[model samples]
Structure formats: C-alpha cells, structure tokens
Target: MIKKSELNRMADVANDRGVTVWVEFEGRRYGVTPPAATPPLDDTEESDLDRELEAFKAKNGYR
Candidate 1:
C-alpha cells in the first residue's frame, strides 16, 4: 500500500508534468481519478479561423 505522502508526491510530479489529478480519501477507502481537462480560450478571431482552416483541411485531407 502506498503512503499518503507518497501519493501526494506522485500528484506533485503529475502536476509538474502538466497532468491533471483528482484524489479522494475516506479513511480506508480511496479513489484516484484524473480531473477533466479544459481547453484553451476560444473567443478570439484566430480561433475562429483555426476552426475553419481545420474543417478545410479535413475536407481536403491535408492533415
């Protein structure tokens, strides 16, 4: 069994590596789950063009 300190250390490493982590503990019961990811901002004109360019590439198999 991993100690709580060890689990916290692992979580720290994961966070440093840009990985998400969600930890839960209830005495003898525990759960380890990665949190949901959030995408970057999408409210700019560049993002709109990016979406359109992606669709164009998909349609032309450029990617």
Candidate 2:
C-alpha cells in the first residue's frame, strides 16, 4: 500500500517529469504544482467527469 507521503512524493516526481497532481478533500478542491508542470484538471472537474463516466457505464450495464 502507498502511504500518503509516498503518494505525495510520487506526485512530486511526476511533476518534475512534466506532470502535476490534483487532490480533493472535504468537498473542496486544491492543486499542487509539480517541480515543473501543471495538473490536467482541477479536482472538482476531474471528480465531475469521473462521476459522469461511471454513471454512463452503469447506465450501459458496463461491468
């Protein structure tokens, strides 16, 4: 299992490699800048899209 600190570290590494990490908590959204990158989407947007996709898959009976 990955600890939160480890995950955060990985996020940092990813940022160094041109990736960014977005995290969500308590219905609020926040973003962290990597050493040299930006997150693809804000947490709320990502969460919304994820929810929509899951709903679509469920509607289509996609197991």
Best by TM-score: 1
Error of 2 at 22 (Å): 36
In candidate 2, stretches whose alpha carbon ends up further than 4 angstroms from where it belongs are: 1-40
Q: Which ten contiguous residues of candidate 1 have the minimum total lDDT?
A: 25-34
**Candidate 1: pairs in clash:** none
User: What clash count goes with each model?
Assistant: 0, 0
Q: What is the TM-score of each candidate against the true structure?
A: 0.37, 0.37
Model 1 ranges with Cα > 4 A deviation = 19-36, 44-63
Best by lDDT: 2
Q: Which whole-number lDDT from 0 to 100 does residue 56 have in model 2?
A: 97
lDDT (0 to 1) per candidate? 0.70, 0.72
Distance (Å) between predicted and true CA of 17, model 1? 1.5
The lowest-lDDT stretch of 10 consecutive residues in candidate 2 is 30-39
lDDT (Cα, 0-100) at 40 in candidate 1: 73
What does each candidate score in C-alpha RMSD? 10.7, 16.3
